[model samples]
Target: MSESANDTAQPVTDWEGYSFDTRQVHAGEYPDRNTGLRVPPIAMSAGYVFDDFDDQVDRFAGRSIDPIYSRQGNPTNAVAEERLASLEGGTGSVAVSSGQAAISSALFALAQHGDHIVSTASIYGGTRILFGRSFKRFGIEFDYVWDADDDAEWERAIRPTTKAIFTETIPNPRNDVTDLRRIAEIAARYNLPVVVDNTVGTPALIRPFEHGADIVVHSTTKFLTGHGAAVGGAVVDGGRFDWAAAERAGRAYPLITAAPRPGLGSMLDRFGTGAYARAVREAVVNDIGPSLSPFNGFLLHQGMETLSLRMERHVDSSLSIAAWLEQQPEVESVDYAGLPSNALHGLALRDYDGRTGSVFGVAVRGGIDGARAFVNGLRVFSRMTGIGDTRSMVIHPLSSTHATFPQEINDRLGITPGLLRLSIGLEAVDDLKRDLRAGLDRVAALATPAVSLAG
Candidate 1:
């Protein structure tokens, strides 16, 4: 006789032990107990129903981890948080309204008013602005290490007040990949946590924790969502950094390790290994009020199912496209580490299996005017200011994204007039190539004609 569906309880799946593709699908999903639904249903309600006054007390008092309010936590958002935590090999995760919030909240969770953060100079323009402008106004300081590979430079930048070391795994536009292992080594010596923005190098490409990152942040608006539909961000806690030890060693991360109330002890004392994430979700995110909607959470979760596949296609198309662009007569350079000609190709091969992600920079021969002709003439590649979408998109950083920066700062960061950032999509590689050729042809078409001296 055949076994019945409920005859025996199957062993629980070891999601962490599974491959990336597998974990992306099944990591945080659980069948509905009441309805036996295969997919986890989105809990749209703002607040969960309480059984009694005592039950409410337990939840509101932080004695229970269950959702009390949507802003703090939602059933749907919880699933996303769990899935992201699993994908990043983190112990916990906190979802926020946007990528910027993820960075702000994650950093604020560690660094306070008088604290400092050392970051790579080549980070996203918005992040740089937030650190230099908004965060600076709030009394938090940020220092940058321009040459990220220089281990001594990283060490020299650290001061007694430096609380954390930060950088993007693969800095946007410019493709100089940071040496995570080396930075982590320095952070370890100082008892400081290394926080990495893995937005571009999604877990599909690189898991920062494997290289010693203690916290991982993402703009779920990018590859995590796959489609250009949802906007969200996540902060994943690797649960390895000893915040208590850091505090004891003179690095003051009191935001998560100190008590704000007389009756309440430190998060580290109460939650142990889960303290960082606990503080992020309960204190920082709740206070900041940048909450991810349940709808976006559902959409983001849907996107993760295809992250592995979309990322693979993106890498393949991007590699071919970058190589082709390098040979173009109207092109100056292609800043894709995937190309063997790139200075960072060896790092790409060792780190990301020779794929540095679909986002890269292409400099056209005719400066700003040439770039305008190329982008405006293209049909297939959308002239949009976004990355990690299912449709190829392009943007000029100097005139748009990084236009506010000082000229010297722009030059240092490689946000040149002719440099165009490309976010290659799932479209046919040949189609993308042909569209790019048309753009280049337009640049040539608009060039000044040679003087007819022979005539």
Candidate 2:
């Protein structure tokens, strides 16, 4: 029998203490009291029942079970949040409308207008833009370090005003692994929270909190949904970092440290021990209005059921495809942890379950024109901008995803003009190989000289 979400039931683990496969299926689920249903049902009502004014008062005062508004919290979203948090070993989680919102809200929750943040150079392009353009406009400054793995670089960049160090577990396109343990040591010395976006690896492959990450964010819009049908994001609070320590150190986080406006309680007081995630919920998300809709939450819930199973297949197929692509004469290199030639292979072996994710890039011999020709000629793989779908996705990073970056930054990150990033999927490996072969053949066909008029 399963326990309720509110029940402090001790989690059960396997011989190795809770296998990743088991946790994916059972972590946040509970036996329903009303129906005794094994799976928690979606609560679609916009608001929950409030017995009286006293009940409402109690809930608003942080003393009750009554969830008043969907904006504040929904049963469906709470269930999904709880399950995901359990997977990451976080004390709590907050769901948002999209991945970008998760980042936006978390940053706001951590720092104030004048405070600074230090981040890795190569991350999701949109995140880079958010830090470079938008955050600067709002008076929040950011410093970018070339590699998160370089402890010396990280130490050198840290300043008194620095509030956080942000990076992805496995960076986009490049497939570089940030050495979490090493960076976390640096963050610890400076008393800064290390926030990591674990979207690419997902919880099945890596849990940054275990490696000393204070907070973890996810674009559940990706592998968490698996099918590419939903758009949502989540922020997991490891509850490991002591925000109280920062307060004791005499710094105030607007969301967590300061007293709430007149009537409302300070975020930490209202939310109790899970204040970090709750701050993102009640303050950043509420003010910004990026709540995940109930229907999308339901779609993500459906996707979560088979996450473990799908990830295994996704990893296996990706490894096979990457290995094959590396051998092709037209392909210059493959960036994936599963491949021995990959620069991050050793890191992946130690940190990942010896399994890297499906997203990686291949540099073609002919540069931009050849990449375009190859992608346009392909029939089986979709030339789409998104990733982590059930079907394979292919895109040229230089002309598409990372096109906005300066050439020097692109060169530094290895997003070359000829690079084609592939998000391998559940399709039969042979079929994918044949399609890739056809694409290369098309490039070859275009390069061949036409028969002479004399012939």
Candidate 3:
């Protein structure tokens, strides 16, 4: 789709000052190509018909023209991108193969061989692995600031080569609410872009851009997709950060210096509003080839139509279950900020209006054996690694998702042996409670006999 028509088709109300709920339903809906139908269709074509040779040359020369290939852009992907951009209050978006790919592309777009990234230690297990190991091979150094809550920690972690400050809105398993505004301030001081993973606290729950985040990324495969069917990710450029300003401040980002383009100027100079996003699309997404399938994009779009409704149920049911679990003796602690007793409750209340996401971790009194028994005993909640599915899911982070992290790192990140992470679904609350009770009962039974031995 050409930017000329699509950009002027419908002013994105959310991005263009529309309310959140209204934007969710009508953000990037293009009238049908053939029949002028309201819903945008999945364009499965691999290439587009150019008007002329000059237009083809213009397309290749970074002119604002329609897409040329499926790998670079598709109508289906464009709809998703528009919707995401609208929802995240961004200038534009790029859908990628996976969340890790989104993170990788976004980082590589701004940082290079000699550049560095300052990140919150509390983040997804896969993200941790990607930054700690994968990016290292490319000579891109990533340092973690353990105390993300401490502004001083983030300030100290920034190096002259640091190009971005990365953190999750609500870190998986940890469930700690990041102070986006504070982090944004810290990033502004250094003239670095703030990249936030808002997968958990989807836009329905929290909009990071409003708090000064320069860019937002999501594992659309999670809550945004609403179901566990697709594997995709999206990056949204808030269009707020002045990349040109960063460059003016002596920040030499890779896409500005290394990418091959003679008259195109630096990414910072060309795409004033979408410099980072355009860089990722042109350089990493085009060269590295992390494109989302059109079919997956269709599924993700369908999922988005009902996202707000699903999130409401997920949050309500999760809060109910988390509260019940807090009263259980078997549960040593519940790591849900919605619970008044949680250490992060105050922060969550302040930032998220007391909505602490559906995904949370519960610490059992007993250790690994107890955790395994509880997960296996659950009837309704599927024992899987993924979260934000329509159906409830349970997993032992220590033994599964966070297993890659060394024990010391895992512990430091608040993933302990007794903790079980749950992705609450839209199932009947009573039914979910019954299913959870069965698992907790089993843990209690096993723990009762084991306590005698300790005595």
Candidate 4:
């Protein structure tokens, strides 16, 4: 698991090509000066003190960079945002309330009434619903590339109103590896900026910007925080997309290029290279009120300090458990991409240098009934909807995460009744295997039950 060169970051400073571990510990942060505290303290203020009336005017007028209200920004949250931005190789970032808010804000900032987005059919069920239900109600439309590997599909679905291309770095459960470079290539022809959900493939595993992603987002509740304690999200701008140029070339992104009002300039005109990020912060996050609390930001930053270590163990344990499960007689199949037999193994190797992500699907020999027994048999693994937690968790998607979806949609997503999504955690590999084996043993018993039905 640790053989790959890309899996481990080189030991160096952030500027001198810092390793992943180094950045995790020191990126976008430094010791305090006023009190000279080694570990920085969280700023718990609701608002900052204005120097005077002129200072207030300057802040409101965009002349001052100092924070105004906690609803808009906070010092502690700012550190987390910058830390994530640096780790993801982004020029700027804005932390939001949750991963959902991050995705919502980014989408809303990029489009409005009558605009559209091109996305992969494979996405988080929550995001699929958000795009299908909430965003649709906003008068915006969505066009999904059911098969993103096909270049023609992406090209065909993109309309002039298509404002952005969305995809996940590593789609959950299915473990389907997205050809990020391929999708970015397809989006480039249309002058579209690719927005990648990097929650699964956090920067420690694979840096999407290195593969041409224009924007990166994270559900800090997941691996970025390395624990399930904090619920937060962030949007990171690569600052590589030329919004003004795209609009000039007829691939218009009105949210960026169009003037906000009759006289005022557009985001692109105001912020230059940081147009998208600025809009996400000022127009969407600020106005819509999905602000991340400073306390949560401090927690997220602390979690990031151990991100590299957690990711390393998570990958190793996941590979171990997946391999052991494949050998079990009660196991039908495992959808882990790290295994050589899986279809996306090569892609994962190339993208991550050998670390397949921790989340994947496991299908027991029995169907939904078998799934129920399997989950019921587990002792150490917690059955929950969240992923990337320090404690291992299990979720039955057909009845949990995607239970509300129609049968056809579930089938389309390959979410069979027997499939149980396992988020492998930081537990000992052998212990995890034993726990799974115990479930498999019960799975066989479930099939041959002693039902005393006296008719």
Q: In order, what lDDT does every prediction score? A: 0.89, 0.83, 0.85, 0.86
TM for candidate 1 is: 0.95
lDDT of 3 by residue, 1-455 (tens): 55786567663334367777767777777767588766677788988988999989988888763677777888888888998888888888999998888888888888878789999888888888888788998999988988766767876788888989999998888687788888888888889989999999999999999999988899999999988999999999998887666878988765754445677666666677877778778878988989999999988887888888999999999889999988988888888888888787888899988897998889887788779778888989998888999999988988887887787888787788889989999899999989988888889888574546554
lDDT of 1 by residue, 149-232 (tens): 687887788989898899999888987787798889889989999999999999989999999999999999999998889999
Model 3 segments more than 4 A misplaced: 1-15, 149-152, 254-260, 450-455
Query: For candidate 4, what is the lDDT?
Result: 0.86
Candidate 4 TM-score, C-alpha based: 0.93
lDDT of 4 at 108: 84
Most accurate candidate by lDDT:
1
RMSD of candidate 3 to the truth, in angstroms, is 4.6
Clashing pairs in 3: 13-18
Instruction: List RMSD in Å for every model shown.
Output: 2.1, 3.8, 4.6, 6.4
Query: lDDT ranking from best to worst?
Result: 1, 4, 3, 2
Q: In candidate 2, which residue pairs clash? A: 14-18
lDDT of 2 by residue, 191-231 (tens): 78899999998988888999999999999999998898889
Listed in order, each prediction's TM-score against the native is 0.95, 0.92, 0.93, 0.93
lDDT per residue as tens, model 4, 1-455: 45687776553324437766777777767557688776668989989899999999877775566878888888788778878888888888999999999998888877889989998988888888888899989998998888877867877899888889999988988888788999988888888889999999899888889999999988999998877988999999999998877878777767777777765678787777677888788778879999998888999999999988889999988888888888888999998888988888999889987687899999987799889889998998998889999999999988877888889888998999899999999988888888888888889997786989999
